[model samples]
Target: MSQDPGLWTVLLAMIAGAIRVSTPFLFVSLGECLTEKSGRINLGLEGTLIFGAMSAYATAYTTGSPWLGVLVAGFAGLSLGVLHGLLCNLPRINDVAVGIALMLFGTGLAFFFGKPFIQPAAPRLPGIPLGDWTGNPAIASALDINPLFFVGAGLALVMAWGFKTTRWGLIVRMVGDSAAAARAMGYSLGQVRLICTALGGFLSGIGGSFLSLSYPGSWNEGLSSGQGLIAVALVIFARWNPLRCFVAALLFGGAGALGPALQSIGISQGYYLFNAAPYILTLLIMIASVSPKRSLKDAPSELSITR
Candidate 1:
């Protein structure tokens, strides 16, 4: 019946870490979900995520307002999304190629503009102490939830609802499932996709805000850690469902937290392996989720055609 304080502490750290780390994944995966639902793949989101991180950090440093930084990040994401959409519309242009190019472009731009703000202090996002009632410092620390986390959660609900009940969602679904059907119904395929891509990028930009303003709380050249690309795989693992994306984000977050949680308890033997847990888990999930039938059952027809 003896209680192991170290185990409890590690658990608390992981719980808190999961909540903190999952925010960006939630936002980016949701954004990618929307983009793919519109039958377009935006690999450029990796670049957008980095750009948003730099933009948010720099804006917060300059303006002394984290919220303003968040807003600007969203605008940056929108701009990038629009650019991707526009470029993809050109005849014979591939979205994946455009996305890779944009990824480099956005990262380069962020690094160029972000150099000066690297060491500057930026405003931090507010957090709600949900663990205050627990009377345990570890628990309290773990439960300090960011407002943006709630925002992303709310967005997931709205997205799920919209996909099931809203007209706009219907239009997006139609465009994704059948470009021919959409065209027959007078919907412009390019326009619908452009709007979805922009909106998706906007959300992704918000995800970037969470990274620089909340967790690591700094502007740096190597901030993103490939979260955007991972989100693409995350969307696939979630089977294109918004709610599933939310849950999957948390799962990935927990995996990411495993390393530090172990290290806190002095488990240094496999530190790198623990750090790599998230990527390994992502790979496993992708492997498990792949259909042996050679058909992504829930994938949009337009996306298949584009690929």
Candidate 2:
């Protein structure tokens, strides 16, 4: 009773899926890249992401403004980032441990507060009609684009340039490379790390907003699906370069879109397994990137994962 989609249709569907799925990955990896550049890590971004989704949905539902929801989500993430930074700065504090704790705390808080708003519908973000001129319903639907993807792409370019040309970029790299050297240059280690981590959280929060406001476009406990944690590996896969992070996110997004793409062409026997592609790719990347002989060439010297 149904006609099969052509090869081109399937390819187009995957491309669309990649564009839609990669936005969150792009934002999260960039956030991690910035935080790690300043010699800190925020594992708690997972929690920040979930909480941001809930808050964004709640705000959009209440105020009838999706943009306002996105803003609130970023600030919510910033607050969590600040908390993680402060706790990590205490004497004998371990960044990894602090991050894990904050992750749990943030997740718990989000679930507790996000209950009532679960059933309510929120205003969703609008999509750009990139394929409207095609005049084909399937093609147009496949090419419907979200504005956040462009924002994430633009931010990646700006971040890459900023790291190379800005004064603050110099400080973040200095601190990441050698805390002693940064101190000698009159930079406060805690201050630099704190600021970068907070900004990272802000970006990640915005990424989370994209999930609830766009793709799945709804808020639920299972909305994140561990994307926040996967993004940490994504940052490493990118080797701390903002531009590389962008590419890596697209790669991961493509892998994630594989199953649905196949399903679109009537290949459904291994659909669930196909969905595991991203995780498999993450594991492979970790294996390839790590070496017993030497650390990653571009890894921050002061980064705990490297040291």
C-alpha local distance difference test of each model: 0.89, 0.90
**Candidate 1: where are CA atoms >4 Å away?**
1-3, 290-295, 304-307
> Over the stretch 1-307, how does candidate 2's per-residue lDDT look in tens digits?
2443467867898899999989999998999999999988889889989988988999999999999999999999999999988988899998999989988998898899999988999999998998989899988888889899999999999999999999989999999999999999899999999999999999989999999999889999999999999999998878889999999999999999999999888789989999999999988887886783333678888988777
> For residues 70-147, could you state the per-residue lDDT of candidate 1 as single tens digits?
999999999999999998889888888888999999999999999999888898998999999989877787788999
Write out the backbone clash pairs for model 1: none
The global Cα lDDT (0 to 1) of model 1 is 0.89
Cα error of candidate 1 at position 69, Å: 0.5
**Highest-scoring model, lDDT:** 2
TM-score, every prediction: 0.96, 0.97
Off by over 4 Å in 2: 1-5, 292-295
Residue pairs clashing, model 2: none
Q: Ten-residue segment with the worst summed lDDT in candidate 2?
A: 1-10
lDDT of 1 at 177: 92
